[model samples]
Target: MKKIGIFLCLIFLWSNINASAITYPKITSQGAVLMDINNGKILFQKNGHGRYAPASTTKVMTALLALEKCKLDDNVIVGKNPPLEDGSKIFLTKGEVLTVDQLLYALLLHSANDAALALAEHISGSKEEFAHLMNERANQLGCKDTNFLNPNGLYESKHYTSAYDLAQIASNAMKSSKFREIVSTLSFDIAPTNNHPEIRHLHNENKLLYSQKYKYPNADGIKTGYTIKAKHTYIGSATRNGKTLVVVLLSGVKGYYKDA
Candidate 1:
């Protein structure tokens, strides 16, 4: 009888220990998601489908569209009517000529609003037309809550996506070799052009790629966003031991890097 009682107590202790080990991390983000990239299975979620302003992470879709529509070496001439974008720009002047390849690096690395506009105009002729393409592509990707109003993720009430939707977008974008390459590149330098004499040096904004405290050695190829309305948003991907995992956070507080 004493041996049987001891065995039952041991079993109870082991079960509790396992439960504690598997508990989810505490997150302060209003919306968060973790996904297994190989099978497209969601591992964890917190308001993953809740709609909020996506800010510049919207460029993931923009970059995808441009890559599909334009060739790498194709020259995109900046038009006279550049959209007046508010935040983060590569300062492209009217009539500046740059290859689609250079624009892509600027778009993804610097989150350059002007570069996004240039790529959008080069592909679809106007922001309105480019947004149409963005929506069509989002629908094809199985995203139901995403609506892109502009190429750069400027704050617009109509431009919103959920954590789940952004994660799916990142996963899809990562499949493209070019997209993957650009995101993983820590920095790139664009030489002086006829219109702009100074070199355009761009650095990636994803802290998880560079910050010592937040760095994830396996992390590569993703985007980040922030705005007055959107707060701090991020899409992060990491691979370990042949497994790839993607994490998305929206409206996160200061500890987003650790929480992610």
Candidate 2:
């Protein structure tokens, strides 16, 4: 009876630990963080303060900066680069004029490196100048561990941030109506323009929008990231009973190990 009781106690403890860790993975990425949106308390953290390449997730700040510094009605000429990007893209032609709003949509949804560069250029006249703003703004916002070496987050030696820092920045970005609008949109309705359009369709890559298999009902707008090293990083959010939570997973690979 003693042995059986001990085994039962062990099982109960193990189950509790698993439950806590499920919502709190210790180091899924180089760093990971989960936060409560209501009061901004950190729910869980794993290497959340360690620096790692943020990859395309860098654009959340890029878009945030653009929305603050540039006017949507402003016409921006795509500077022969965004459409020529080698990675994920929506393909904007060189010299094509798009409103700052349109270019922003391109940057946010497509994660187009060129669109980021173009938006940077449009906002600060050059990517280098815009990068300066990114770092400064991050500091201003109290992201002590964050740095921005490029507007597009293309993995530079000097560019790095932790999942905690990412969450902080995301928490701020979430306050913006424009940012929320863009990320929540599963598909954007882009009208045709002279460059080419019969209503170009853009889809949000976030798979969670498709009725989460894990029973999260209020899941909504967020971002995903990966690189050769980063391996399927994701930032997710959802609302439950009027409470919101932000979950960050980094350095994650499927079928290898769960965050818990």
Candidate 3:
């Protein structure tokens, strides 16, 4: 009988050990982490601290800096390269005019590289200057592991951030009511202006919004980033029962779409 009792205790201890080890999934992929907003505790993590190409997720920081440095009502004069070109765009044309807010909408929602340029220009007077500002802002945020070489998460060898650092960025951005409003919006309709079209409908790239059935109940605003080098990266936030969670996934496969 004593032997059996000892065996039982050993089993219990082993089970507890296993439970602790199972806190979160193993980080086999590039980098990923889920954070609880209230306590800032890491609910899950995997290679989160390692640097990797963040793709367009970097735009979150760009948007943050633009929001802080410029007024939404301010107008941005469209420039070349980001408009009427080959790649992702907001249909922005050289010499066209758009409000800072409108350009922001196009930049964040549409992932329009051109929209990013116009907003960059509006904020720093030139793309080169804006890139400098982005780097400075990253440092100010204390994201020692993050670096931004471009406004859009477009491919630039110098642009990379760890999942841990991206979470850091999202944490600060969530504090902004404006950021929340812009990212949570499933769709945005901007009336046509003299310089542009009559109507602009903006849709978020987050697949969670598109499918409308993410396992995460409180899934809210945020952006998605992708490139050949950066696979599919997502910075997503969700809320439930007043508690919020932010997740960052970098260089992962499509299987992670369900929101574990």
Top-scoring candidate (lDDT): 1
Worst 10 residues of 3 by lDDT: 1-10
In candidate 2, what are the lDDT values of residues 118-223, reduced to their tens digit? 8888888777899899989899878888878887777677788888888877888788878878877777756776787677777777666653433233557677
Instruction: Show how many residue pairs clash in every candidate, following the order shown.
Output: 1, 4, 7
**TM-score against native, each model:** 0.90, 0.83, 0.85
Candidate 2: residue 95 lDDT (0-100): 76
lDDT of each: 0.82, 0.70, 0.73
Sorting all predicted structures by lDDT, with the top scorer first, yields 1, 3, 2
- Candidate 3 residue-wise lDDT at 126: 76
Model 2 TM:
0.83
Which candidate leads the pack in TM-score?
Answer: 1
Q: How do the candidates rank by TM-score, highest first? A: 1, 3, 2
RMSD of each: 8.2, 6.8, 8.1
- Residue-by-residue lDDT tens digits, candidate 1, 84-193: 66789888889899999999999999999999999999999999999999999999989999999999988889999999999888888888889989998999998887
Deviating ranges (above 4 Å) for candidate 3: 1-22, 26-28, 84-86, 210-215
Write candidate 3's Cα lDDT for 218-258 as tens digits: 46868887787888888887765666667788886665554
In candidate 3, the residue pairs with backbone N, CA or C atoms under 3 Å apart (3 or more residues apart, or in different chains) clash, namely: 82-114, 183-221, 184-221, 192-197, 192-198, 218-238, 218-239
Q: If both were scored by lDDT, which would come out higher, candidate 1 or candidate 2? A: 1
Instruction: For model 1, state the Cα shift of residue 16 in Å.
Output: 20
